[model samples]
Target: MNKRLLSTSFLAIVACLLWATPFAAIKIGLKYTTPLNFAGIRFFISGLLILPFIPKFKAKLRGLSSKSWKLIIQVALLQTTFLYGLFYTGIDYLPGALGAMLIGAQPLFAAILAHLMMKNDKMTWTKISAILLGMLGVCIISLGRADFVLTTTIPLGVGILILNNIVGSMGNVIVARDTQEIPPRILASFSMILGGIMLILVSIPLEQPNWTIHPSEYYFALGWLAIVSAMAITIWFGLLGRKGVKVSNLNTWKFIIPIFGACISWLILPNESPDFISILGMLVIAFSLLMLNYFNKKRIKQ
Candidate 1:
């Protein structure tokens, strides 16, 4: 394999692991602060941290068309506002691992949306089957208990999270196609700043009047999100730049994030243990991801 491809693959794996832990972090942080406030502070810190680095980042943004800027805004809204908001809120009701699994459906949504929206991308039966298997896995994991119907709120939250994933997948397609002309670093930085600003503005009305971080644990969570999550995004886009968006989509292995998130939840929160069906669901998800990678590789070769 090429050195760049190898390095990008490694980075993608690391990013997935870092992201997986975020649900636990968010769950912990929520104890100290409201979701909107927590998300706002984290984004602000991340946006500011990248400021100095932004000047050194290189990618062509000299003559972006108005259409491109509009697309970037759309990407920011989908990724930052709708997606993150739903995710954070969902974590309040569901285990992080479960949340991750729910969001794991992104690649499936991406494949479907890409087929409809993009000219180059097409949906194949293999992709459709992979999506179906993945969705079945998620259902097994998420709703396979005798008291399954008892977790009504969780399903609602997961529904929003799924929508978040769909929007994110759509944004990924946009970034993949458009960012080819723009610099990844520049685009990442700008998107973060824009998204951060939007969150701050949104939080003004939706969040508590006097925001405060209660426990010191909140700070740790914030730090984890700012450094790990934000940095991973930068790294993700960088990898995307070197490889195409399709190649970068492989980063969805971070889908295991929900699994890690759920494990942490079982330890820290009052979450129930996974039943056999849920465990089976988890296996199905893993298998689906493996198949996705295999099919993606085969498609590339063909």
Candidate 2:
């Protein structure tokens, strides 16, 4: 493989690994800190980590048109603030594995949104089938859990999580379509900084001034979220720029995140194993990802 392809593949794998660990780490960390606080800290750390690299970011912010700024703001809100806020809050209520599984439906949402919003992108039967399969898988996983029966309260949490996925997927499509005009590195860095600021402002009212690091485990979890999850996303955007959005979508292999999180939860945390239906759901999601790749390739050839 060429160097670009090799680097792209490696970055994709790294993104997946970092993403998978977030659920487990968050689950552990939530034991000590509030979701809002955790998210704020994660973003802060991520911002600090990337500060040194800011000089390398090539986008000419001053020269950007108002339209571009609008696009960037929209993306930051949908992809960063709304999605991450809802996701972290949902994680407070659900297991890390389940949260990941639910978010795995994002690509399906992206496919749909892309077809609707982008004239160049059309939804094929193959894409539809893959999406359906993934959706079914999520249903199976949810249904199989003995406690999965509809509780009015849990549904609220799940609904928020689902919304997070939808917004995130839409953001991805928007970013992909717009990358021709906006440099991904500039977009990613600015979005992170803006999103971090937003999260901190929001958290000020929601979270107390308890900046206490009560446990060493909390510190570890924060470190992982900051260095791994947040920074990994920045790296992901860079890869997306180099590889193209469709190729970057292949990073959904990070769907393995929930599976890995689930396994760790079962082994290390006091989390329960998913039922047979949940296992089926995971398989369905995996199959859907394969179909997405297949159809995406077929469309390119046509």
Q: Residue-wise lDDT of candidate 1 within 1-302, one digit each (tens)?
A: 67775575577767776776676687788777667767767876776676577553433455667776776677678767777777767765766447645666776777777777777667777767766777777667555632333466787777778777777877777776666766665666667767767876787888753565377787887888888757777777676556444532453465555555556556766766756876787788788778877977887899
* Best of the candidates, TM-score: 2
Off by over 4 Å in 1: 1-8, 54-71, 89-102, 143-159, 242-244, 247-254, 262-279
Q: Give the TM-score of candidate 1.
A: 0.78
Question: What does candidate 2 score on TM?
Answer: 0.79
- Please give, for residues 156-243, the per-residue lDDT of candidate 2 as tens digits: 7778888887788778777767765766656776676677778777887887636664788888878878888456777777665553
Estimated TM-score for each candidate: 0.78, 0.79
Q: Itemize residue pairs with steric clashes in candidate 2.
A: 137-281, 141-278
Best by lDDT: 1
Residue 262 in candidate 2, Cα distance off native in Å? 3.6
Give the C-alpha lDDT of model 2. Answer: 0.68
Task: Give the Å error, residue 92, model 2.
Answer: 4.8
For model 1, give the 10-residue run with minimal summed lDDT.
141-150
